[model samples]
Target: MKILFVEDEATIAETTIPAFQKQGFPVDHVETVRDAEAALSVYDYDLILLDRVLPDGDGLDLLAALRRAKDATPVILMSSIRHSVAERISGLDRGADDYITKPFDRDELISRARSILRRPAAMSRRVIEIANVVMDIEARSLIVGGTAIRVARRELSLLEQLLGARGRIVPREAIERNCYGFDDEVSVNAIDVSLHRLRKALVDAGARIAIVTVRGIGYMVEETV
Candidate 1:
């Protein structure tokens, strides 16, 4: 999954970005509320990690704006000053999916993020099954026609996006935004190359599925009839 991390503290960001990366989640970090808003306008993120104290303004204002716009993207509010029970309640009431105090354990934060993603509002599950392919998301394992196959991280993310859509066309722009971090140096044909390799792997593993390319548009996953 992709995350938008809004925090101004360089030390905390330096420590936390790698933690999420280790779990295969690409993070786009913005230090200020304005940068976070700019990023949100450009890309769709699976989760948002919002810091309550920001250089520009209160993070709660951003959260409130998001809720007002009817954006249901899961958000976890983080703060050191707002760790009290009443403040936490206020943050939650302002439309945060969860509240995490600063000086938190990285593991605990990851666990809470996973829990939020599994909720019905997030529309992600622990496992996904489509045609002869079965993906255990938490395990990061792919089983096609009872045979296991190894997929690169990017391809796995692309597959998850496609499968999650349940056969709907996933736009190329969306794929690029979701599969790669803002700072990642992606080549012009990177998505095509990865998709080609994924298609080859799936076919070799006897998956009864097709990753169809719509000319100049995007791609979709469908069972081979």
Candidate 2:
């Protein structure tokens, strides 16, 4: 999962980012609301971890604006002001999908993140579309411009990781974690080989989307002419 964490606290930022990364989620963070908006404008994220109070602005206002724009990305509000039922309701009413008190369980939070990522619309759906190419998740099928294309399971797994990142650049380690699990033998060449196959399959299918490799970084999938 690709996530944006909007918080100003240094200690919290340092601790949470690594913890979430350890759980296989790639995260980008900003200390102020303005930076958060800039991040949102430039990139797509699967989930947002927003703090209610910020140094520059209220996180609720950001949540409201995103909802007003019809952005349905899941948001989990974190706040110390979650003392009253009214406060809780206000946060939820403003558009947060979930809310957690300031002091939270890391394991529980990780589980919640996993659950949110595994939403029905994101998971159960057989096909995922990016530009003209559609990935049939269940059948391991790939269709581009109405033509069917075959792909290897590992290639499909890599595709799913890219899709799940919601267009953000996903790192090689994250690709390994999600695509292969803890038990599988992971190698740098493994990811490279699978991605090469995926790219070839998409090109062979006349796909309108291409996976762009960010050298010394990661990969992002985007529409192509």
Candidate 3:
């Protein structure tokens, strides 16, 4: 998804840009609120990561302006200073979707952003993240540790079923039904062959996830951690 990261702190912007880009999320960084306002006119973003403090004005002002213009872009507000419950409530009351205090975990920040984006009316995507690996169903590709790996169509379909189960055993019959229609002829070991190829591709791409067999049952996919 496209994201506008409006952060005035040089160090923070420098540190965050690459980290988000590494995960296949497109991030554009800007320092001042004036520049941020201009950017909003030029581009459309799935979300805005707005810092509370800005060089020219308060980030809240820009957020307020956006709301006044009837912009529906989701925003996650961030601040270096601690915010009291009332202050946080005030920010949300003003139109921000989520508030994040400084010195937060980068992963947690991304997780929160993803959670906000995953809301029904916000960002529409069918995606699953396990470790650093991101399965983009719409893209029909797997992003493993920031690198996009080309996947066969059939393999992509198979991976989705396993990942959606969240480590629970997904029956082979279920997988077959998903990968092939009812009329398609199936080999006795077709599923096994497809799983092997998918496994090999994940390894070659350095994904930190694995699909494991349940011996007497089906298969489960889990993060390598």
Candidates' C-alpha lDDT: 0.90, 0.78, 0.80
Name the top TM-score candidate: 1
Q: How accurate is candidate 3 locally (lDDT)?
A: 0.80
Assess every candidate by TM-score: 0.89, 0.60, 0.58
Off by over 4 Å in 3: 123-225
What is the TM-score ranking, best to worst? 1, 2, 3
Error of 3 at 224 (Å): 37
The top-ranked prediction according to lDDT is 1
RMSD, candidate 3, Å: 14.4
lDDT per residue for candidate 3 within 166-210, as digits (tens), equals 779998877765565322477999888889999999999888888
Candidate 1 — which residues are off by over 4 angstroms?
123-126
Which whole-number lDDT from 0 to 100 does residue 145 have in model 2? 92
Pairs that collide in candidate 3 are none
List RMSD in Å for every model shown: 2.0, 8.9, 14.4
Give the C-alpha lDDT of model 2: 0.78
